[model samples]
Target: MNTRIAALAALFLAAPALAEAPAMTVMPSPGCGCCHAWADLARAEGYDVSIRETDVAALKDDLGITPGHRSCHTALVGGYVLEGHVPFDAVARLLAAQPAIAGLAVPGMPSGSPGMGDDPDARYDVIAFGGTAGAGEVFHEAGR
Candidate 1:
């Protein structure tokens, strides 16, 4: 009985570490400062982020990210794609829900969006795209 209790305690203690977020691979365009900033923000949020500099245009094309859904950087995490300066909350929701979509996008670099700038009143939309018919839909709205 004491051995079983010890094992249970060990499992409980290790649960939190096991629940840590999966590692993320971020592909950013060469010479893009904002992309690096965004990766830093993601790291601050406790995500294991790895940055890989590459030709973003070709990468976007290969990933099926349409022009309208393009962003300066792209990330792959938990089998989902993230484009641009996507907020941490939105990414959290996507991971939790595990929606049947190709990924999420923030489109252009909004003023207050993550890695863009600190504008309290900036507003932007995170778009979910490439599910069934490959249409884009509003996934989340950020800022004021």
Candidate 2:
């Protein structure tokens, strides 16, 4: 009886840790301040983030991120690629939905985007790419 109680307590204690979100691996362009800021924001939002400085151009090319979809920083999480300063909510949606595509992108450093600045009026789209034809579609929109 005591053993059963201990087993139950252990399981309950471990449940939250087991359910934690997967770690995010971020590769930022060397010397890019915005990329570092974005990573900091992600960490503040409770994401388990790891950073690596690298040549972003080569990484983008290797990842098949089209020229139009390039960003200063790239991240890999839960088997999906995240390019640029994508908002945490967008990432959460992507993970929850697990859509059949390559990944999400916020494209260039748009003003008001995360790590860019707090521009309440900044408008941009989170683009989802690498589907059947490698075309991009709007995954989510932000800042009106």
Candidate 1 TM-score over all chains jointly: 0.82
Across 1-144, the per-residue lDDT of candidate 2 in tens digits comes to 123323422422332321375677788988899998999988887777777666778767767788999889988776677899998888988888878777899989999998999575679999998755334878888876
Across residues 1-144, which tens digit of lDDT does each residue of candidate 1 receive? 123323422422332322475677788888889999999988888887777766779777767789999989988776677899999899999888877787889998888888989464678999987765334878888873
Residue runs of model 1 more than 4 Å from their true location after superposition: 1-18, 133-135
TM-scores of all candidate predictions against the true structure: 0.82, 0.82
Q: Lowest-scoring 10 consecutive residues by lDDT in candidate 2?
A: 9-18
Worst lDDT 10-window in candidate 1 = 9-18
How much lDDT does each candidate structure score?
Answer: 0.77, 0.77
